[model samples]
Target: MLMLLWNVLKKFDLLSLDNEEEIISHLRRLSDDENYLLRDIIQAYQILQDCFQNITYQHLQLVKTVVEYSNVIEMMKKSDLYSTYGRRRFQELRDNLTTQFQLQE
Candidate 1:
């Protein structure tokens, strides 16, 4: 049950929320509804892999990679790494990461 709640929090992007009352309020708001989204973390991972082109998203190895690359993307956004060259490099890196995640047929 606790894991289920954790998955919901992660899926809803509410994990960073530290206010207990607010968290309870949100839980109450979602009570008995949208049960479809309350999945375990692995299922969420599979959903991510399915939605993307080639991301294999291995259960054992993905957490750090995602966190690190995601930070890079966020930082780059604030840094206006959106210049033509930077954007191209970022895309190339993105595509390369996709290839790295691809599953062999």
Candidate 2:
């Protein structure tokens, strides 16, 4: 599932596509159990979301990168695995992204 999600995000150019097959293979080897897989996916999503939401403009390129990943963040909110807290955090991120885009305009 994480691989699927990553593939979708990669389509939007939010994540690197390099060695994708190898990454998926390693993720599969890391977890044969469904619960473990789900947990890892959720944790990874949360961490990435938080990172984008808390981004500072100390480096302009980093800010631009986070903005580019906003589409991936938006898609993540649609996942059934997204918890209530995750939904709230996503909303906050969405608002922040909107503000950033507006400022750019």
On the 0 to 100 scale, the lDDT of residue 54 in model 2 is: 43
Residues 13-100, model 1: lDDT tens digits: 5433455455445444454455645454355454333333343347324543444466675887886666988888878888988888
lDDT of 2 by residue, 8-92 (tens): 3444344336654554454465445555566677756564453345444564355455555867766775663388887778788
**In candidate 1, where is summed lDDT lowest over 10 consecutive residues?**
47-56
What root-mean-square deviation over C-alphas does model 2 reach?
A: 15.4
- In candidate 1, position 27 carries an lDDT of 49
Error of 1 at 52 (Å): 37
Q: Give me the runs in candidate 1 sitting further than 4 Å from their true place.
A: 1-74, 77-80, 103-105
Candidate 2 local lDDT, residue 24: 48
TM-score of candidate 2 against the unseen true structure: 0.25
- Residue pairs whose backbone atoms clash in candidate 1: none
RMSD (Cα, Å) of model 1: 13.2
